[model samples]
Target: MGVMYRPPNSGQDQGHKMHHKIESACQKGKVTVIMGDFNMQVDWVNNAASGPKEREFIECLQEGVLEQLVMEPTREQAILDLVLCNEPDLIKDLKVREHFGGSDHNVVEFNLQFERKKVESDVKVLQLNKGNYRGMREELMKIDWEQSLVGKTVEQQWQEFLGVIEDTVQRFIPKKRKVIRGEIRQPWLTKEVGECIKAKEKAYNVAKSSGKSEDWEGYKNKPRITKREIRKERINYEGRLASNIRNDSKSFFKYIKNKREAKVDIGPLQNDAGNLVMGDQEIAEELNKYFASVFTVENMSNMPTIQESQGAESNMVAITKEKVLEKLRGLKIGKSLL
Candidate 1:
């Protein structure tokens, strides 16, 4: 989504430059939507543009395979606001009826045509936090591993142990159900704002068909009041979020996280197979393979110019459990923290 605002009467050069930038942007993105106040006085009925710059703008947009969706006048007699997309079917139900609070420009409401699959996790898991640890420990202690594993192979014994532990967990531990987190709601959206938006929509609908100047005047004044209310509500919302952040830090950080674009820590890397490795693990593996290829085995036969230490010529001994216990016994741990 590219947001743009070109000031009115800003020269033709600036318009050309902006169009060039938009063209460049369209070329890079798979699906692009450039929106906002372009301030172009276009004669959509006759398929004509007023100035040379507007004509060039339309030509440049077409060269880039872009489509301007807005046909109605967003501000008074000229269509200042515009919504453009590279793909023809990328934008759907493009409506220019409603006005946003505080702006003279009519709001362009539309939905991007796509399907986003919700990535749900597995259904059930152990809630260890609420588990009966004492009961589980007692149940485990009752199992005699020596006799249990006497006639079983290593793999069989492992399986048997796992089965017993699973049974114990089911008996003692509670289950947790994983669900998707709540969606990020707009911070500025309030009950008052919602009512105002509905009113603007209703007013716009009436003004479109009705010839009454009173109806047009009524619709025009709604936005100014709505904008003021929006500002107040937005400030209050932000203030509450700031003040209660310490108590509800998850929501605050989640909002922050949602605002920022997802970071690509590891970029696509080409592996030995000439295929792009996109995942973090795959990229790590590719890097590891590259690093492993550069490593050379050192020749032990030809040692470096250094003498071996001969100060302590004692032979090392094998470590036994008995020796470890004896060492522990010898320690003066009377005042040890542990």
Candidate 2:
């Protein structure tokens, strides 16, 4: 059975979960040959060779216990294709083959031999920190540690300060981990690449339109069809037409080549802030200002308001084990902290 587009919803965590499920199924006396376009690369490969997203996928596969068969030299050349087997020794001779399907991906073939054994259940439990210490350190460092609070009570300022620390640290925490098993049977294309292709097509159309208009305007009042003249005209027109077509084809392929080169640099593109948040820097600056604003107190007495609004409420609310667990799961799954 072929499965496709197994969602990487849990990111690395999902990879782990999928790994467990595959192992479980195989251990039950089933000779499982999991094959598909995983849409991921292995972590042992560099990001430049695998791309960041592919690298993350590779990390997931490693965490989940799946091994990659092909090792493409670069991420651009990296194949989304894969074939995995519970019985590796049986299909050690398998190799990739070319097909005439006109598809971007080539067909893969492998053989497998299965031998049942008493499978031992291994539970690898990892303990992770509940709080983001690096985030907490960064947030604490942002505070005006030497700022004086003349009017506010010590309790108020303390509360406000604590709130800032907690909020900043929480922002760095991961939210979920998911396990995904399957293949990308369909081609995995990014929007950026798609848009680039469209742009190239548009450019080609524009060139074609310009050429037609120029030809028509140049020969608008030419003589009506005469046997010899028509033949000559036909020859001239055909030559120009073929030239334009060649140029258009060249232009189109050039566009694609440029787009592919641009795609090779997509590692930094994944970290783009605009893609993740609206007005990223502005929002970050605004948040910093908001936190800074609360810390300022004209008098010691004024600190209570900041404290009450920020600190007191924070203290009243508690993060339960379920919430922490959820966060751990999220982190495992590849959720990013903003």
Candidate 3:
């Protein structure tokens, strides 16, 4: 199903008509994929706080057992364009690309993987912090490194060192095999916001059952306030993170990259002769040749070698438990590095 030009001021009557069509289609029980410019935010996070059009759409989808796959915004900080499926479990790698040209909608892409035919792929997983690092260090301290190497040949010593390390690692850092699944969720979502959403849902139910003017008013006003609170919570959470960028630059940049999905890899390059260089080898050769021609060195015959300072002292400090704890405290809980 495709929708377009659903204006912002579209009345509830028009929304109902659209919802009826979708609901009718869903009642057929065929695998349904609804996509295009919805021009509506479904408010999936705070289920009850959606606008009238979105509310109707959500209700229709819920009745049809449909789930929206695209979470990120498709327009200016709003998920206007949507990709919804009745069987979300069958959908894999659902992604929303940046908007194309001047269109307000983004390019939505996904893969269909049948659950019945899904081949289980083994994944090696290990949690580094799950191991007793102190115990491992203590065990290593008991070993006589000098004596272990003294009477052995170079190859024998290498093999012995490798064996000891491998044994220790296997004993401490155990690996588990598991099957890959779906995408992970954002960490900043809070229980407080969730409770507020539930309250809004309750209010909506009260209004629907009672059908009183005051009850409807309360329902309308409560969700608006709850949405505002949710926005404020999100802003404050991100504000605190903005302050940590300088200290934890690696994590900060990683967070930005994930949020924006900003990995760029322009494959293949065309040379000046208009011949396309396809592979890495050909591309590298072309780049090297271009650079060699453009680069210049004055008085190359009398170039002098630069020497490093002999008196430089390293300012390296030992990583203590306190330092590690402080670092952990600085990072937001549940936030992943990737």
Candidate 4:
């Protein structure tokens, strides 16, 4: 269960999806040994930022009871290559070898002696297509909310609302649950990079057969330069995305927001009585109680009131169709409706 060369700038959504896929696979495998080029430069020793994808990968390993074996830098200057195992003690002689086989990724060597356990896992994932939000809205509009909620208690009303929304989601969006198998693909591994890698491989084979030092050196240097080119292309691709901030502002902002979405998984929390509360119901109740106490008013007295100063001119202007149209025109185009 090794991942090689993750998409660098595919954004956080893909990274999270990839992490979950890997985690699910690890869970099902009896003796999991996940390795390969994660492309995340993590300084686990120094408590440094390892980017969102790397952080998620680390969290996945933690939750799955997996331990990373490779501790040294495997790439040029970064520990991009990783080797993880469920039984850290079982994984012995874990080290990064020199670049081999015409590849830029350094080889990770490890030994493990454990019986493969047969584990069954079922993962039900709800995937959403937010792009079809217009269709979702149309479905919602077709439902008579007032009629559905009529003659019901507050709790019943809430239940009805949830039921309708869940049903709508099932209808409008597609969902599937199945046995988890790790099958992650790198979309950013473009054809050009593929050709460059192939060329390096051909160079390596030729050097090996001819026993030429220059050819071997070329094999080594070619892959490095190719990797650099691939990296440059990826960076340039992100630069194009940055340029979209003006022309395609909605997508630009959405990308930024998704990239920064919280990956932290908050587990069970303790209540005031020091009892650990789990599940949605207990968590919501605890949160509501805490907020209610914080916002509770003691005595309602001497409240401040607003009074207009004498001779102060009112800034309110009369609404006009032309003024409204002008304002609308002034607003930036391609902005999200909501």
Candidate 5:
């Protein structure tokens, strides 16, 4: 069974083609059932006031030989609901059940003697040899350490480590197997961290202004500044300034607390049971575990080299074969026949 929402402005020919495709798919002994809010009336038996669009829709249904499964006439004078079947003969009974009372549309039900298709067994192919890691030491030695570490801070290095783990499971795991994953390269962090740093700097500036004001007031009534007094005031101001800087730095670090948390959140070292009670902490820990598992050197080891090759090949293909076929179909060949 398949369902779709077709818009009113989809055009007549397109609508006809959609019906044809469903019919063709069904005729291939698929026993397919297509139902949806078609957004058009198939008949005026229930709906007395019919427009050209509704009339056209009814004509199309007749042309396609779509069996109307529902016999109950709706109070709302629009044939927006539909049930189409390729193997109408297989259906023992069909009727529109009363609104179980919540939805605007009526529910249609059908009974059939149909056998469920057997699940196909998938053959697993082993591709990678465990022996490949024997040469991993050589590959690791060849990698440019300076190049890889460039632009990476302590925090970024930790994040990159987590990213490697997440990429592995997503890329290698079978689709049917359920697993949690995290998006590693979050661009939003750049903006979030930048804003946090700016806020911290602003607070530091405010604190500096307040300390300067205090110094100015203390010296306002003095006739001349003594060397000892000058040194003392300078020391006092510097101490206050240092304190402000420390506080600001602490706040900035706190803003990136999640990233710091992620660094220690995975594998045997994880503190999941303790962290789970704290929602934000738990999210950070989960993200850390996910990233740690996928974004490893082992998973993305050949990504840089493969991406370069694929990107170059993709650029060389002119217009792409897909686009060319689309252009060919767009040119009208038989408008008169329609």
Candidate 6:
């Protein structure tokens, strides 16, 4: 899903850039949907020739294999609003509703036609705090790796050692699965806020049925109180996160990352054939193929001799373990996606 709003005063340059970006998104070969107040006066329904900018934008959609779904006029008579999708049947029952709020453009409502993807979250985790660390240590200490792996190949030796460690962990560690009934509510939602929410719902229902002024006023006042309670609870919860960061840095960092609203997941990708790849294995293979195609590794064994420029001398030196270690020690560790 994508949203865009191109200003009317902007010239062809901005439009071209926006078109390129949208085209690239479509190239990802995902279940794509792009909607915006494009400000393009294109006659998509009648197949009439559009202006320079409109033609360029339409050409881009064509090149990217995108289909325009919205046909009705959104703002006055001209079709300034558009809903573009790569899949022809992905968008269904698109309705042009009345003007939304103070906006002049009509609200375009549509249902996406596809099975919603369910993301699997962890239900069970290793309970490291209850693990038998002493037993594991004693068991590991009993193994004489040098004598046991004396004649094995390096890979085989490493595998055998890994197998022992895994067995030891399994024997000593404990894990439990949690049963989650529904989507987990926010940790910040306290009893006061929950009660406020219930009161607000009750007031709304009473006001809707009676249509009394006092009942409506009672309903209206509930939101302000609810908001205040919610604000206080959230601040208290965040304060707790900050205070406990040393002991639970992961939770604190996770909350901070969520607040940042960053998209970290690898989006739907496609191979050279332009077919959607969704499965983890398939996506990985497609990415590998793309990276392999882009990156060409040269054979360093065949070196080319280059003549040094005049007045320039080579100052190459052999790398030492101490020097490498010193450089590594000076380097700062950073968080990276890789």
Instruction: Give the alpha-carbon lDDT of every model.
Output: 0.81, 0.51, 0.74, 0.73, 0.55, 0.81
TM-score-based ranking: 1, 4, 3, 6, 5, 2
Q: RMSD, each candidate, Å? A: 12.1, 25.8, 13.9, 14.2, 31.8, 15.5
Top TM-score hit: 1
Q: Give the residue spans of candidate 5 off by over 4 A.
A: 8-17, 26-29, 44-52, 116-338
lDDT by residue (tens digit), candidate 4, 99-135: 6545566667888766789866566556674336678
Query: Candidate 2: which stretches are off by over 4 Å?
Result: 1-4, 7-31, 43-65, 72-76, 114-338
State the lDDT of candidate 6 residue by residue for 126-234, as single tens digits. 7899999999999989999899899998768988998998889888998777655898688899888999878876775686579799987776667677878898999
Number of backbone collisions per candidate: 0, 24, 0, 0, 13, 0
The lowest-lDDT stretch of 10 consecutive residues in candidate 5 is 219-228
Better of 3 and 4 by TM-score: 4
Q: State residue 158's C-alpha deviation in candidate 3, in Å.
A: 22
* Model 6 ranges with Cα > 4 A deviation: 1-5, 20-32, 41-82, 92-111, 115-138, 141-167, 174-186, 189-233, 243-254, 257-338
Better of 4 and 5 by lDDT: 4
lDDT-superior candidate, 5 or 6? 6
Candidate 3 residues 1-338, lDDT tens each? 44435677888887778788788878897888777777776665666536566776777888988787777777757777777788777788887653343344556778877647766667777767688788899999999999889988876998899999989988888777775669875555688787877777677567657869898778666656677778888887777778886666676666677788566766589999998888976887788888899877679789899988899688997999999988888876435651
lDDT of 2 by residue, 124-180 (tens): 332236657776677677767657444667667777777775577557554444434
